[model samples]
Target: MLAGKRILLIIGGGIAAYKSLDLIRRLRERGAAVTPVLTRAGAEFVTPLSVSALAGEKVFTDLFDLTDEAEMGHIQLSRSADLVVVAPATADLMAKMAHGHANDLASTLLMATDTQVLIAPAMNVRMWEHPATRRNLAQLLADGIRVVGPNAGDMACGEYGPGRLSEPLEIVAAIETALGQGSLTGKRILVTSGPTHEPIDPVRYIANRSSGAQGTAIAHALAALGAHVIFVTGPADVPPPQGVQVVRIETAQQMLQAVEAALPADAAVFAAAVADWRVASSSGSKIKKDAGRLPVLEFAENPDILATVSQRKADRPGLVVGFAAETDDVIANATAKRARKGCDWIVANDVSPATGIMGGTENAVHLITAHGREDWPRMSKQDVAARLATRIAQALG
Candidate 1:
């Protein structure tokens, strides 16, 4: 999707600066031409030679080099790219950008550029949450700059919170979203993600190995393409993407109700691993542990959310996509599921312990449509989601 696009990557100083190298390679792999500019502090972490080598272009550093300025003026340099990306945007750099300071080449380009700018911030938890930093962030947002992540996780300082830079593939996905042709701009999409927890008692419950990473990524990708997304999510470790309406649920029945409420959308993606069954009669309180006897529990089938939505006679979505997570005969089972559920498409992935696709960062899926199964290569969940979102957009059109 980024073929022939010009990307101006501004490297900021931080421990996560290394990830920018991978980001450059990934963008180049997708046929984007990269121009790298390094801040003075950024040079402390990564060498100009390394940046130049990875980008296959000269690294711009000095703001007052007469020869370089004669060749390409700073104003032209700033305006040449389709997009400006600042990775590891430190607190200092952010403040400078927010206040329009042009003390350095990086800040000057950021101030002078007219193109859309995307920033990925990396800092300590305290620094990220500081009132000054928060104000700067708000200013950037008000100025229409797109911010990707300062994901909550362990930082280089050995502390954990919202200060980690997003992974390389995630940054790539955001860039693609910013540059996509808006194929799904006018569509309305519904997606369900995560694993439903069936309560056995107030304290204990039944759940699965679904992290909802893939499904949540799908919703974000759809929204990035300008689609109005109604995201019905079960309990997940990760936070939901911004700019999309989210509905929270904890059980199969709740998910079904949420999906029903979001009907008449252009497409539906049943990616949540809804429980197969629930406790027939859940205890109001925690069950007491007996000295020698095991408690007897009864199971009852949960509602078939995907099948119900796909087979709806009134106010049905134009297209329905279901996910089949299987241990054996993945494609065959998914094919049967597509036929039985009457969904327009089925995405099948093997979740056996041996495969490790479940709750993992990557996936290999088969897209089962009326024509045949199209096997995709093993890739990051974000890539898988973006590709699937694009396909849904095309199908909707």
Candidate 2:
């Protein structure tokens, strides 16, 4: 899809700038031309020579380059690309982009560009979570700017949170979505991911080992196929995919409400590992460790989100899919779940500790349908998501 496309690549100042080199190679390998624009501060991390070598073109810098400015180079450069991508979009650059500060070449080009823009943010965890950055992110999304990641991981600063630049392939996928090519074009899909936290006390909760990798991958695949995605996620270890409307929740009840609110979609995928039960009356304050005698806790069954959505009579999606993560009787239990939930399909998997499928990268699953079951080989979560997305597109058609 990217063949012959022109990508205006802007390198921002951050440790993640090194990833931009890999990004250029990935884009070029897929037949996209990259034009590199390095910020003055960005040059501190990645030299202009390396960027020029990867892009096989002259690097653009300095707003006052008399040679290029004589012909209004900035405007021409901005308008010439099919898409504008900013890797390692630092806090300063994001702030500049948000408030329309055009003192530098990179920000000036971003201000002048009419092409669709996608950014992969990278920064310290604190900076990324700051109110100012959050406000800027909101503004950018509101302006239709696409965002990929600042995926949570250990950072160069020895702190860990959501500030690492997305891997090169992930950025490539986001670029594909931004470019608007896919089988599920014009479709809107809902995906729920992660393990819901059922609060038992102010600081404790019932949860699972779900990392939400599969669900995140499914959302990414759907978006790459040109689907509008409403991602309702619990406290997921992984960040939500790019190009989706994210709704974060902490409990099954909240997840259900979020799903209902984002209803009237073309399809829905329930991949969250919601807690089956919660404390009937959780303490508002932290439960003291030395509270004399052992406190007895009453448990209440959590709401069944998948069943509610699947059984909805109004605003029901054309396709409703549920997941069955079992440690025993994987096939029998999942088949029974399909019959019980009334969902169109159930993706069954053995998430037994022995299988290591719960929080692992690879998954072996069974596709259970009204017709029959298809035993699939163990594969990476991303491959499974892509396959399922293709099936969904066919089903929708």
Assess candidate 1 and give its lDDT.
0.91
Q: Which stretches of candidate 2 lie over 4 Å from their true place?
A: 181-183, 186-397
**Steric clash pairs (candidate 1):** none
RMSD of each: 4.7, 8.5
The weakest ten consecutive residues by lDDT in model 1 span 173-182
**Number of clashes in every candidate structure?**
0, 0
Candidate 2, residue 382: the lDDT equals 76
Candidate 1 per-residue lDDT over residues 216-294, each given as its tens digit: 9999889988999999999987788888999999999999999998888989999999999999999999999999998
For the record, the alpha-carbon RMSD of candidate 2 to the native fold, in angstroms, is 8.5
Please report how far candidate 1 places residue 245 from its true position, in Å: 4.9
Candidate 2: Cα lDDT at 214: 96
